[model samples]
Target: MAHDHHEHDDSCGDECGHNHDHSHEHNPTDELVTVRDLIRYATSRFNRNKLVFGHGLQDAYDEAVYLVLHTLHLPIDRLEPFLDACIPTDERTEVLEIIHRRSDERIPAAYLTGEAWLGEFRFTVDERVIIPRSFCAEALADGLSPWIDDASQVTRALDLCTGSGCLAIVMAHCFPSAQIDAIDLSPDALEVARINVEDYGLQDSIRLIQSDVFSALKDERYDLIVSNPPYVTAASVDALPPEYLHEPAMALGAGEDGMEIVRRILRDAHQRLTPNGILLIEVGHNRAEFEAAFPALEPVWLTTTSEEEKLLLLRADQLAA
Candidate 1:
């Protein structure tokens, strides 16, 4: 089951590596191709192409394993038992093409597979929306028990700019009694989020509204509000990798300093939150601007395994002040 880890350069302007030069014509019995071989070849291609990996995974080895396993419909988490298994010739061709597309076209694996993971939660993602990778998901999974005085007392929750309804759905699971409202501007993104909400069978618990920020709400207040709003500056949006460009620009950019929508959120959050209600928002490397924008309001930065002090938590009193 040894695999050749040769570095493959497929950037040659023409034939895209679909046609194998050698006579290794995928005769399974003749030239055996195992899962190990696929992973090694894919890893080589990924490294050679230098594909950016920030959507759901960060390393070549894990991304390689995911592409191979996900393409073949094999178990992604448990790969040890399938390493030596031979890939069916028909399926091998598809997997090889997928890996090639990933490297040559620079398409994200999440888009290739149409799924993403958010803190042990699986979501249906597509180009209609950004791939779900949020520090907010991690904090929510921790039950927000670290900050909320009594987790059970939280009855209403809001997910602003809720892409794919991932946060709203997860909140429904964490707080069964709490009613949740998730809003977004794009009808297409809401179409995708609607599907996710139905897939999770949370239609009764999480309500989806098509709106730009708090415009769609009048007097509805929430005990807890979590948002992963568009905080990427215009400059940052221009500098983002090709994979990031695959997502909708509306989901990434806020303004020149990436705080336009956030400022509006702060403007009305004091009225939207109940007494002692909490707010959690992810700013992703915009801490400097955040600190300068509202210096008076004390923001308790929340940390996750992904980033430190990037997700901010503020109380109603501080926001009101």
Candidate 2:
């Protein structure tokens, strides 16, 4: 259960030592023939091993389908059309080996595949950044309606703890007129974010900066400031599943009670926001601690498709007052 490891270049073959010649036939089992069979096998193994999910997917079946489809180069979204189709002998080995590594090593699927999706946006990911799973993506996709009133008026935005720059890229698309500054404390995480920003051809729209929160942007104010900061408490981080440990340690945990980074954001947000600017932060499962920390401030809780009260929204005026 070692957390400090790099992704293999050969798709787990570096550790397994399996050949990947798809044309060559080599079968380890007679049962795992069709895509359906492989999915069933992988799902059974995942459940039996008590593998953890939630990097992007929710359960064993979803993870099996995703890995099977991704391994075969099939459409990740469409599984029915290819469910009964027979998988070739060599390809079956490749797929099974991936399944074995997943069950045994407890590697998150995104790390194995080297990619992740937030809505229709696909990002190149690795161990450097935590997988892009944020409730903020849902809010940004909806244009933060009623709260913002108009998306075009958002002239400038900031994405704090912009690991993988996924939210920043999404913001670029959602608020086309806005200039986004995406900041992360880790230089390695910033490198991954740079790749993602460049992949979306958002080089001009999203600017990646290595900053400890807002320290790098002196006096620069934003119409919208959004963060999915490290809110996992120390105890929670310690008890996280092996899959969760695959993510960067610095990107996951705050101090005790998980409000260390959050406290800093709140302290300086009022100064860095425009008069009517909005501040949004995703404090995953820390509402009780959030309320305890700042009992005087009332934030409008935003709901996503997955969870109720997943994010908090505050206006600049509220913060200043």
Candidate 3:
């Protein structure tokens, strides 16, 4: 499936070959289309224009349903049943407009709906933060749990650059014994993170803070410090899709070479990390650049099924020299 609407001609009408005028349409009841009916129509429009990727139409349709249901505060699983039951004409029209925007504008569903899921957690999101896509969740779920030194036990953990607080909440949930800090430079991004933390009832366990890296950390140190910082080079960012433009630039670009942020983090991480502490950072496709820049630092590359991910693990001891 393709999500590019430019693939088809606009002259084609609905299968009936009748061009229905969209103008002068005010009362949605005049168009008593069901939710399923809207979904079918949207899917057809998407398919006709080739506006999605492999599974694009399906994904877009699902996203459309989610956005529509979210607008009405309805549960996603119950959307179909509700559609089959009785959807007010106004509601159907409202949902159709959202679907049309998604299908025609090629806007990402996450941005369209202002929400996304990380693990079992749903977060309120927008262009202020990058969509939650951390492989750290894999490490947490797999119990690749970091190690702490004898002098310092794993009492607290910090998720630096905590976009949407997904990682921070997950850390709090995974390590109930430890206090979690979700720190970010952007206050706007932190707002989204705060919602997720509260939504998961991890407010007591996780604290949201606004800080540029270790600036606000002061004398604070952690047994486990993880960050999926901005590692995209300026060139790469420029080449990204239009949808990527919707994300915060501060959450994406690091520098000309993309290592500006990562290098600083690696240099200063040892100071903030307790002895034997570990720091995991996702470099995406910039792993080679990172390795080449710091040959002396032998960071462990995390293996994942995701080809685009290039996560690296570093120990505080490794930086002692």
lDDT (C-alpha, whole model) for all candidates: 0.86, 0.90, 0.73
Instruction: Give the higher-lDDT candidate: 1 or 2.
Output: 2
Ranked candidates (lDDT, high to low): 2, 1, 3
How do the residues 193-272 of candidate 3 rate in per-residue lDDT, one tens digit apiece? 88788788887889888998888877878888889899999999888766566678899998888998888888788888
Q: What's the CA RMSD of model 1 in angstroms?
A: 7.3
Clashes of 3: 7
Evaluated with TM-score, which candidate comes out highest? 2
Off by over 4 Å in 2: 1-28
lDDT of 2 by residue, 181-245 (tens): 99999999999999998888999998889999988888999999999999999999989999998
The whole-model C-alpha lDDT of candidate 2 against the native structure comes to 0.90
Clashes per candidate (backbone, < 3 Å) = 0, 0, 7
- Model 1 global lDDT (CA atoms, 0 to 1): 0.86
Error of 1 at 89 (Å): 1.8
Find the candidate with the highest lDDT and give its number: 2
